[model samples]
Target: MSVHIAAQIKRVGRTLTANRAFLECITGVWLLTAATHHYIMAPASVLSQVATDLHITSGVAVWLVSAVPASWAVTNFALGVWIDRLGDYRMIALGVGTVILTGVWSWWAARQGVFSSLLGSRLVAGVAVGVIWTASVNLIGGAVSDINRATAIGVFITSAPAGFALGQLSTPVIASWIGWPASFLVMSGAAGLAFALITDSVRHLAIDPTTNTASMRANFTAVLQHRAVWYGCAMAFAAYSYYLFMNSWMPTYLGQRFALSAALSGGLAAVFPAMGVLSRVGSGLISDRLLGQRRVPVLQAAFLISLPLIVLIAWTRWLALIVTALIVAGFVIQLTFGVVYSYVREVVEADITGTALAFLTTAGISGAFSAPVITGALIEWTGAYLPAFTYAAVLTAIGLLLSWVAPESPHSMN
Candidate 1:
């Protein structure tokens, strides 16, 4: 009886410890991701202030949002081959450091009111962010068990929207308190704190270094040879294009269309990315538990459902209805994010997962880079918001088609 009781107590203690560790892991990952997002998105929240402060046109100011992704696309493509060799921990550390330094540069430029300098700093930060994104996805996907991979990643993916919401809701307030440029430095400090939280937790997640250049070449070749990767890229391109388009323009749209104050419009625009908090995690659960670990179907459904929602946003005149449409659209469209992150990792070999994700990042952020510029140009061309939103819906249709044909993972836990 004594022996049995002792064993039972030991098992209970182990369970508690495991549960605690799991919670810490989730919190650490979420916060770290959120910090990066807050830094990246802070500018979009105060674009008008930035334009006025720097004396640039709205056309030029839009590039402040676009420049990061533009450089991110190029950097992801160029640096992906080396991620496996450098390992996740080092890459993430480097990314954090780069952003911190860039933050200072941006703050100085903003104080000087140099548009070119501010823009250049954003472009440099984009390079760091690409590696950070690729490595972080690889880390999350590799950290958990196959049984819960999608669910864990789904939860992890929520950080993007959560961070976006945080930046949008907080940046204007922060700018009001300390001016727009200081928001950059403050967000970078937040990133530093977030990095500190995750540093100890993720140290064990670093990849084993590749042996040589030959191995790096092989990893790159292996990822490129996989046909499913191209399909995932197409899906990513569509999803990111739609995601960034809404995030970049919605505040401006709301301000212009409804004659809302900047604070009100920015707060309202946040509802779109905010929906990811539920959609990303829920999609992961639905795919893992309900869909039997099938990812492509979830991806397809997200795109299909989001198409009408994008149209609704374009066509609606009522503010309440537009907000409601944004809520649903944000949830539906963001389902693709967590699913694609998990899907790409599962389809590729473990050794080359980083490379596969790098490709996805490159393709997706290229869409992110393009969407704002294109939408702005379209709105300028047509002198209306309808054509811009229509362009987004068309992108969703393309993504839906791509998702329909994407190959399901052969290693499905189901």
Candidate 2:
């Protein structure tokens, strides 16, 4: 047993700090990942705090939760290709710098107790998210070899859900002890720490080699014409829509529906992202090892399995059943995130990899927040969670139909 434990420790230690560059990249990604999530989840984690402090309903409070990803989507569309083409060290450094400045603003704005100010701070923090997130994903994807693509993408993305889980788990307790705004302060420190450690590491990353130099319009138009690219974009939109809906609204939903406290509600909601962390790695491994020639099967199964679980959440009154349903839903819903990234990389031209990524992410992030905002307004109009769950079901169905027809990547078989 001791020998086994030692071997496990050695394996983990080797992977985590394999070299200075790897260390910096993973650590920076994890911290910034945590920072983005912590920023939005502060509101989600303390939905009651926003409601009381800002004089808003739970639905209105979620607009603050949705705002970061909305801005992130816009930034992805606006800057993804440009950053991919022209960015590297300076992009990463500036991204980190933006997060630090805006993270502090988020902390302060939330503390001041105004709705618009808090929403504005979250939006600005999202720009930082778009910058850092694009740089980090590009760095990891470009650095690794094609053979290991799924594993690298999967492992790297685990950081986001991990950060989200960390925020969800800790923020409620921190908010309870130190006040809600303090969570943002702690998360800001995390982003600051990442900037300090990561800037130098990014300076050394390998540039993506490319032969295509077409005009932006031609590059985008080319990829857009491919069926696989559309599949990736469509999946991104559906997956992110369901993810953000739950993340932005579930804490408040649990609290209001179950009559639980903020801390407890956050803890319960934390189960979702926590499951996501492990499921992402598992999905990647499945793509890499079990289904090396395909990703659509994994992607399709994820959508099909998630439908009932989502409905269960909206319909069930029993806490144990709801939690169980959420855990399963979380696992199934997250599989596509890691698998499709590798899949997207396989299908798109290397020159516009970032452009394609921007396309996918914008489609995804926009899908993530757009309907939820309307869902918020819908809840105002109808005063029930059924409409949101019904919407999630339809989106998942659409994802399934798309995945069924998704073209298999040639690189995956090669």
Candidate 3:
């Protein structure tokens, strides 16, 4: 009897370890994909090339950058409903395949010198990215034990900014060396490799059980009626406002305002995201430790700190001060999501976790999508980035005000 009990404990321990390893592997793949999608294939590198080749202004080139987020937002709403039914592995495979094909198409478009075709390929790539990112987040969150869920999510979320940082740092160098078309081909190949790895590892994992009619109706009804859902959506918008603006506009701002080179601008833009990667994990760990206490205060603190930094970055002309302000703003703005996700999971039902996360992501993406256009318009109107930066600071302040109103999870309190 004693021997049997000891063996059982060992088996359980091995299973837990395997589960953790699996989650980590997926997280790594997701991070790489995100990095490639946002930084490498992102509009910034493409915008410069397309604008130069087509003799267009940066404002028009902004569409190439903005289209991906717009498509992502639309696809996420539809994809979220069907992702669980199709299975995580199937969704990943499909999403990766789509992205790979889009990369090939983008290369072809670039070679053919057809501007519209290149834009079309980007939009298609955006749709695939939307499916992959949303599914990956929900799948990883579901796979882990509740006790470790926040930590897993934190790690997963960190990959995105890490990827963005890497993308920003690498894209310009690659583009400078081989040009944009070849750079996109390399990204496509990487996506294909990630697809193969994830598909092989996830093959044996159990599929999420199909939703029944009653549960489906209940989930739809619950999400629609829940005030927490609205709050979560709002929080996502608030948290991502700064991220969108900084990631989309900051590189250009630095280049134009401070007379930095493309490589230098891209490199500097990476600092905030790199710092954000650490802050994201730290915030998650902090939230997990304080699960028994209050979550609102931590979230409130992140938002409040973000406001002053954004203001400083916008209002100050000093290069040293602007860099410092951007770094601080990046840390606080990116850190808020860790707490937001934890709060959402604690309040929402387990069955609809994907939908809940999808809604939040959609809101955030909306903010990201709209931010560039707004900033562009502001620049066109006022001929300066300060007004746009100031606008971002106001958005953060409003988000902080909303964070106070977000409902605390009853489960978290316990």
Candidate 4:
């Protein structure tokens, strides 16, 4: 571990200190992405309250939870070229700006008890999120050198789990004091701060304002034809499926099985995503240092380790034991999340990173959007959680197989 840490420090060199522009670009992009996640998840904790207040069935209210990702899945693909044309900084601004706008709109809609208005706001926010997600990564990939890119991106991706955990833990607590609407307001305020950070920092970054239709067409064709990109997409789909499965259902599962309070179940489930804060960066450090920047091996190991852990999470009845499994599974399952982002970019040329990542983001978030819905449907049909979990385990097994056979990034494999 000490040797790995030293290697990381040596690779990073003066990037952290002497390169002030890179530091600011990464910091702003990280905060911008984190704020988008916070906006995406702010309502998750209060969905029950939303259902009760709006006089809607729990079934209809669940859309409030899934709506953002569902919309994100579709728009992420549609916005691929637009992301390139607008350049990273403009796209980032547009995305963060939209989140701020929609956050306020959702808050107002909730205050008025209009379910459609609130849901509409979320769908719009999802579009913005898709924009931020792709552009932020493009900015990171473009800003850092290939040698240090994985480490930098790993650090950037930590914002996701951090923001997710923050929204899950903070929203309910904030609602308890004032009201659920206040949660959206707080999220919007956070976005406002992110906007300030980004606007102040990213002025020095390069802008790729490619407006030629022919160039866009060629880039799209190049990304679509790459075989390794598809493997990376497959890994993304599986990882995201497992991620959302746990995020969406674990709290309710704990509540149903153990009779834990909503707060307690949520707090426990929060442990799952919370683990990503450390594991994402750790995976990056290990891949960059210990594995000589090899991403496929880390991905293969994560999926292989996750197979039994998923089964253990599904069947275990002991609270203490399940919590232990959750901790380990959380870290193990998400080991690929940060790595895949780096993998997809490294597999392709620098010019088309945005287009390549669009395919990856689309596939990944599609899994995220579909997982809970599919699992919920299975549980409804079978009258049990076992089948749903089995489905997730099968997906992870497929991911492991894909990682086993997938080609490694030529540049990254020393």
Candidate 5:
């Protein structure tokens, strides 16, 4: 019996080491996938072209971009519940396969000159993204230990903004040269490589079963009853509202308000996500260094600082002021993601961590999904960007208040 206990301890140590290595590789692939999806299929590039071809207004064209997050909101909840049962590798494999198939379909549809088929292809990609995002984050949280968890999660989540930034940087170039369809083909090939890497690395890990009906229900109930989970969800929702607004509408705002060309607007938009990637890493390091300190204050400080910057970017016409505001907003908004993830994980049990993450993701996706449609309507109604920016700013302030009110879980460094 003593020998068995000793062997189990050694095995756990080995698993921890393997998990860290696996997370490193997984984060790289995740960044690739995120950058491609955000930039290639993003509303700014693909939807703009498709809208022009279809003779639709910008308001309607925005749906193509909005559909991805909206679909993700619904699908992520289901996928989150099932990820443990399917195992991380299998789920990732399925997600990659879906991306590959959809990429080819997207390319073919673009070639066929059929707008509806292309839209269908984008929706298919959205489904895959929903599953991929949820499973990947959960996988990282499950595999890593508490001590290094925030840093690992910070690296992984930074991919979200980094991917968006890369998309902004590359989309215009790809669209101008080979055209958008060809760009997706390139992305498909990349997804294939990522799939191969993830599968190879995680093949030996244990797969948990999802068939335990009662336990699943109990887990959901427990998460629902947990205040920390709700607070995390609220924070994510507010942060995503800011992120989606920048991602979906910033280029159009530049084009409409500033009279910039698509290429130039895209270039400017790239800076926001680039700053976001850096901020994510910085915030995680801060959280790690201040572990057991007052993290809620740190979160509130970021929110309060970012609100005015976002408003300034939205309202200003000066090129220098606009650019500076965007850079600061990106840094501030993107950093909140890792902090929220760390907070939730600290509060939840390791066994049900995936479930907790799914709830937070759902809230974030809901915010992201709503931003485009609502912002489109706001623009349609007000004929100005001020109201939309104001709405986001107010939400950020509310998020700050919520952070203060939320009870810090025992898991916090404080």
Candidate 6:
């Protein structure tokens, strides 16, 4: 009966696949990719164990988490342009297959206790993230209908925070049983599953090589010159910087600042991403359905609401208060990705979506990638959470300012 019900669902889903299946499949894969991406972040979640296992300083150990996003930022930018040229199958296969290989390499490096090798493997994994992310964005923007596009992107963008929360929520339990290397082996399997779902679905569309040189350069310049791209990238930088700090180091901060145990800190830290799952979706719905496609107000409101919460989360001593502030902060802070994504589609020419997304990815990730290492340095220098949280509040304000500079596209003129 259960199998019969499963078959029935599959049949019904196939019928719906005409409009819904591709979006839904890639969205699920996006979520899973996020889970795998954040799993590497889990080493920071248990900083002590990693330091002990590798016999490294706390500073060096943090790089295990930092390296992935940094590499992912660069790789995402390069592949964003290439996705326009090389087509989806190559990127997806390169992406999905790259992670599977690199996961094993990461596991091997971990077992061998080779720090250099581990960093190299992590770089490979980050490339997979960049390729998959670029391809997925290009796919959704170019393929999906305009009417459902915002709604689809809203749900799709939730994958990042949802995956991070799942990784934080599950890693401690799984790591306790299997050790960290074996835990990553599990992540590899998850990546493989997501790959299976999307591999056959590539549209096989790509730019002609004869048009590549001048066209790519022209597209690059055009996307860079656009005011919407500037505002989008700038705001993304601020929003993602705060998010990267939360996803990568929130547990570490909680554990140190409050002297909480790993499991306990991980549990509490898990609250941050839970709010992100709601934020992007809610902002997307409000943009599409309620606001009639104006995205700036939603973004500005997020920054405004988040500003107080950032200060509140930082200044508070009470655990409950800190957690509550984080929940609110998480919700508002995450509105940028989906809202801005939909907004970007409106402002740019249809053909260069990949390069436009690349600019946003590169710029946003530049901010996100820097946060971990910079926050680490701040903590090293100040020896407290106050500086770090204060830094975050300042970042939120910058986002608020950028929102004002960013012109509103209540309606897509394109």
TM-score of 3: 0.88
Q: How many residue pairs clash in each candidate at the backbone level?
A: 0, 0, 0, 0, 5, 0
Each model's lDDT comes to 0.81, 0.77, 0.72, 0.83, 0.72, 0.74
The residue-by-residue lDDT of candidate 1 on 261-282, one tens digit each, is 9779977878888888888889
Q: What is the per-residue lDDT of model 5 for residues 294-353, given as tens digits with 9 covering 90 to 100?
A: 356557877888888887786666988888888888888877886787777668765566
- Which is superior by lDDT, 1 or 6? 1
Candidate 4 lDDT by residue in tens digits, 261-322 = 98899889888888898888888888888888889999999999989988888887799999
Tell me the spans in candidate 2 whose CA falls farther than 4 Å from its real position. Answer: 1-20, 50-62, 110-115, 172-179, 203-205, 209-215, 248-266, 311-319, 378-380
Clashing residue pairs in candidate 1 are none
TM-score of 2: 0.84
List TM-scores for all candidates, in order: 0.88, 0.84, 0.88, 0.91, 0.85, 0.86
Ranking by TM-score: 4, 1, 3, 6, 5, 2
* Total clashing pairs in model 1: 0
lDDT tens digits by residue: candidate 6, 1-414: 999999999977765664455754665567556756566566765667777888898778878877777788876765666766676556766777777778888888888878888888887787777777766766665555555566667777777766665665566777688777665665578777776666545432222232233366677886777788889888888898888787667887789878999778977877787777787778888777777777888889988898888787777789888888888877888887778877775677665677778778788878988876788689889888678877777888998988987888636422
Best model per lDDT: 4
Candidate 2 lDDT, 84-115, residue by residue in tens: 56654456677777777776787787778777
Worst 10 residues of 4 by lDDT: 205-214
Question: Where does candidate 3 stray beyond 4 Å?
Answer: 2-6, 9-13, 20-24, 35-43, 54-57, 203-208, 212-219, 252-266, 290-295
Arranged by lDDT, best first: 4, 1, 2, 6, 5, 3
Off by over 4 Å in 6: 1-17, 202-216, 247-262, 410-414
